[model samples]
Target: MSRLEPLTMPVPQSASPATPAARFHNVEIILPRQESQAAAQMICEVFRAANDLFPGAPYRTHVRDLATQMRSAPDGWKPRTAIFLGGISTRWTLNSGEKASLQRICRQTPRCLFAGSAIFLLPETGLNTRYETAVHANFAAAAKEEDLPCAPAGTLTTVSDRISTAISSFAALRLLTTYLREDRGAFIADAVCDYLGLALGPTADHSRVSLQLRQAAGGDALIVKILELMQRNIEEPLLIRDIASQAGVSPRKLERRFQEKTRTSPLAAYRKLRIEKARQLLLHTSLPLTEIVAATGFGSRSNLTEWFKREYKTSPQAFRKQYYAEREPQRSLA
Candidate 1:
């Protein structure tokens, strides 16, 4: 009878393959974001940390922010300092290892930081919202949940971007304020809302089910349609509002559904979609950074450079130099 008690315990192998699982992990690290002068050492420390845990782990991208305006950040850039996840295991795939190291920095997860801190969940776009740039260290880890519509990046960086001075949103404005930062949760919540608005653009939710049952209980179709549209037009530089319109819903409705389903908004999704495309472009092309910026709808070289600096923490030129270009020298030496 005592032995029988153990039999009821579900073996690890018995777990359903489809169940969203939590990756139980704890991480603590300080990313010095504005310390680009020490970026090389930081890079080494990050790799060492990763190797310490998962040996022979296939590494991805080393995203860096190369902003020179460390003392006074650009209009939307300051205080937004933070790090790319320095050491974390990406969901392992067959080919990821083969492409590991500096040569393919374009397609890997960027190891990013800025202004002596790491920014979490910063959009790769040129604009920075009233989100708290950073005051403390950021923490993030992967927790798998029921499948949600994802960008072609096929990934999400669920993280906490530290708030130095928080602000609230009245409707539309990316500027910062002190009121929001006082209440951390509310600030984060507001940031999420703003990003969602960006994602939803002007779409509406046509969720007939929720309306039929609980007046606001329907969202599956809206979510599904939005995902499909995003996937189909992965290459286009469309706005979140555009995605909402395609779903036959208003931006507000679509944003609501996105919030309900994925706990994030459509604008974040759109930004990520474009960032993922840029990632692919970085991996596959020898195109100049300016050309890449234009191709990815990043507006101008300076803007794209700023975004790249904030999102990945390195200038595109440095990234290409370390990963893609320098390899030839190594080969020649060998």
Candidate 2:
């Protein structure tokens, strides 16, 4: 079993300089009654990642609950885009004031997005009477009963006029990335997706070779399956021979296919995946160095640091510090 050698790979660079935009777009994430806090936080995390990668802080996000109807948005708080997260119960009732507030916000905002069960709000608020909505299968019957215009079966998301709807929270993430790609560029959107360990999806038209090898694996079914196995077994990496056996190919064939498709050996590709996972945990999480090493299958802090420095040109601690140091001022302002 050979180990991955120290290879210096250039970090993904932004296409433009870090200059502030003329004006930041305000985005309001509305939780129409009780919703998943984790879902709302994930949405905000995407925006934050975009802000970190892009030149300027192009978006300012606010999480508001319609359960506490304030009658109107606060002074000087004009949201350009509003997103309604899904998790509310179909039977959960809303009063006139809440419904009115939802309607008012939807009418005022230039763009609106509904995720998961939040599609129900479309008809309830009189916003999507004429447009087809991407309703989750779990809520399809309910949506039909409520007279909501449901899109065709298996539709993940749909956009009509100024409104967009998604069938599930995962689809909502992809929709948000699509919006980001339009607002920013493919570089920024793909970079953020790479950092979050998310697929850039079929809509991405970027030409950069992604650090996540799965993105560049092309149409090789064997390579794709092996890459997925590598991703799933990050905490306890599998040996090349074992992986080959599980993938139903000989070790020699696995190595040949990986090299042909990814231009890297099986062991090297596996190491890269683990290193990338370490990078994500370092930036997006508060886990300590030892925990990160253990989780990424590096076996020791020194090993993790050596490969992390080789891949990212910085030690894990320094990388984490530099990233958050740059983000602290933005947090204070927010």
Candidate 3:
């Protein structure tokens, strides 16, 4: 669902909210692995999700041999590259031919080109995957079906270090491949989740707060925890009194602390975070305005539009258009 070519790919299956197995389906694609250029081209085509990010700089790989080993191996790094999937109908494993083909396309290349488009059904991890090392571009996922959150989908810049984390993101596509001779979908899912956990680190980002703000809170861990909770549940209509009770303080005391540290009331801060989340959804996703309204707890599309106009002086549609128009030149030049 991330991105696909003219070729056929698998589609996601529906499952009841209580059913985990029904949430998955198999997806596969077999590219032309004979010629290096053809193989790289095929890979780029399949990873169109990433290729499209930097339009002028499409993905490329130029490697001549697979027998060459890496210059040096790092400690505690067991380098093995394999694809994982879920809801497969047949057993699969990496046969000699496919493994050799992959080595020729990836391992042999000095800088192998890789892209993947797939979807993964995940449990309630609060965390998802992403490929960017910094925080400029949008973090995109596939469609939102029912209430399931899509896995992070993108391209990897390198084949070492945390390459597994980046590649696991591409598995968000609805397609499944059977290049393996044994059933490894479950194993792949586990590995992907573990790698993603490592990549995302051990803590959730509390809205990218600054050290100055932390100091302003006067080392108030309660205030920091409350702010993080607000960031985590941006869509929920959480009341200040509830937050105050959770912090073991009166609503008035909580408001005083918020004003002292953040120069805003608790509800005001929560609303700001919700609107910010709405802005992100508008920029990164293709969901309808109604869906965005629901996701952000804006009560209605008109309410969302009102707040968006108040903040950005433009409708969501116009904001999206203007944002892209501004970025179009950069993408073209890239």
lDDT of 3 by residue, 100-153 (tens): 544433332222112332122111111233323211012232223323232333
lDDT of 3: 0.43
Tens-digit per-residue lDDT, 125-227, candidate 2: 7654677999887887888898888899999999987889888767888888888887876656776786676764544322122333544565468986787
What candidate 3 gets wrong by more than 4 Å, as runs, is 1-201, 208-219, 330-334
Residue-level lDDT of model 1, residues 79-117, one tens digit each, is 112223222222211122222321122222122222211
Clashes, model 2: 0
Ranking by lDDT: 2, 3, 1
- Candidate 2: where are CA atoms >4 Å away? 1-22, 69-72, 88-92, 200-334
Superior candidate under lDDT, 1 versus 2: 2
Predictions in order: lDDT: 0.38, 0.74, 0.43
Q: Could you tell me how far off, in angstroms, the CA of residue 94 lies in candidate 3 after the best superposition?
A: 47
lDDT of 2 at 264: 90
